[model samples]
Target: MRKVSRDRGYHHGDLRASLITASFELLAEVGLRRFSVAAVARRLGVSSAAPYRHFPGRDHLLSAVSAAAAHDLRSAIVAAADRAGADPSSRLASVAEAYFRYVVRTGAGFHVIYAAELYAVPDEARREQTRALMATLLELASAVGVPSHRQAVALVEAIVAVAHGYTTLFAEGFFAQGALTVDATAARAVAAAEALIRAAGDR
Candidate 1:
């Protein structure tokens, strides 16, 4: 006799992906402190134990989500640099603009990727991935004669700071004071990046 299964929608081979998707939705709704594997399973209409088959626990699941977010961020950065041609200054500006645009586009996912303390997982891999992506901007700064590794890194950090700061301020409605549009804000971010590169050269 054939036995009936009781997993409830867990038969789909893509349940792992589904669980990840649900986790993000839950994250958007309740945030990381309250997010749980059982909630993801419930969202998938599966047994609470179903997620354990794919992820050992919530921390592991969050790590996967953070990794995926980093991959997406890397793609956006690469595309922006490619579009800016071979000009180092142009590439820096483009990449910075793209970073801010991506933050505006993806919102909370950006925080999930970069905010390490929230997830309670090792973020060395994520940091390395971020470093790799930032390497292009650093190389461009170097090409344009930043003169030393420290200065190049400093320029990159300054640019990233502007982008990150703008993202946070915009999210918090700080831009509402000026009624600045996203395009306007991104333009300012690009200008800030370009100014930092020029300032490095001046020093």
Candidate 2:
């Protein structure tokens, strides 16, 4: 029931981009359930239907946001791999650390992309984007000698799951009661992940 603006200048200056940005902001503030097209229009100073010109509906907007987030994550993993130098093992470790860091730093966006139930239905386009993002990590795993393509994919998936689970627990203050700092915990987790990957390779 939010009010929409009657302004006419919204068409110029990347209205679609503006609406997407506003939608992400609202998503971070209130999450998916409370987010609405009317609310986004209110935030963007446009008529409620204006967004429909670009996004068919709220689901489309959510999908766009999820795609953007997936792209960002893919870029981050690539950068982390590059920063880890030419060593495959180092690259794998760096990717795990980077993935964890991304989830923690971009918690809201990460939640929307991975945890939001709005995208429960399999959208081919979104799935493709997510697959590409995961492929980067799998490629890194392969480079690190994960035995085979299937093994590489499995290793990357396991590492990512561990990192994500630990990060979620960390965010919930699971380790705050301990004497370790967040950085220390993350380092330990990354090290453990590296060891696990190496062991898997040996097997």
Candidate 3:
């Protein structure tokens, strides 16, 4: 039998990225419960112990993947905020829409990141990255004139909860039976979030 090398080739420059990609595929197929470092290595056609060379265990791999997803989501939100221009209402709508789209596109991965059970002991760096992403959204809320900074954070959190909840429901096909398309549901949710923002500004 040929010797199974963990590093594959000499340089493992792309090992981390490859592992993360494999992790996402595994998540989409078997979900977070069945996810494992050995599975990821197997998916990547590497030695079963290959992943352990980089990831301490399954939790470390999950945290790394979740952190990457969070970064992508944060970037998407920032881009949407930029595209919304200087209009407060437009900015708020853009942020909500962006968040919804992200959830739709990254359902399984997002679930892993947000699901409490899967990430009960998230890496410290991943936790900080997640917080920074929330902070970015809160800053956008403040930019839209959400009164005080504290209120901005609260408003953003509320909006996130609504968007995330709606996305989860939609993914489970709840609105499909109600004659509502994803776009339509997203629009309604964004409109409702905008109304809340306006109401907060009024108070």
Judged by lDDT, which candidate is best? 3
- Our model 2 lands, by Cα RMSD against the true structure, at 5.3
Candidate 3 similarity to native, TM-score: 0.78
What are the Cα lDDT values of the candidates? 0.72, 0.73, 0.74
Model 3: CA > 4 A from native: 1-13, 28-30, 108-111, 114-128, 178-181
Alpha-carbon RMSD to native, per candidate: 6.6, 5.3, 5.7
Question: Candidate 2: which pairs clash?
Answer: none
| TM-score leader | 3
Q: Per-residue error at 160 for model 3, in Å?
A: 0.7
Model 2 Cα displacement at 57 (Å)?
2.1
State the local distance difference test value for candidate 1. 0.72
Weakest 10 consecutive residues, lDDT, candidate 3? 1-10
Per-candidate TM-score against the hidden true structure: 0.75, 0.74, 0.78
Residue 15, model 3, lDDT: 76
* lDDT over C-alpha atoms for residue 66 of model 3: 82
Error of 2 at 190 (Å): 1.5
Per-residue lDDT of model 3, residues 1-203, tens digit only: 01224443423577777888667666655667788888877766778887888888777888887887778788888888788788877787677777787767655434666657546664787888788887787777887776688898788877877887787777777887898876888787788788878888789
TM-score ranking, high to low:
3, 1, 2
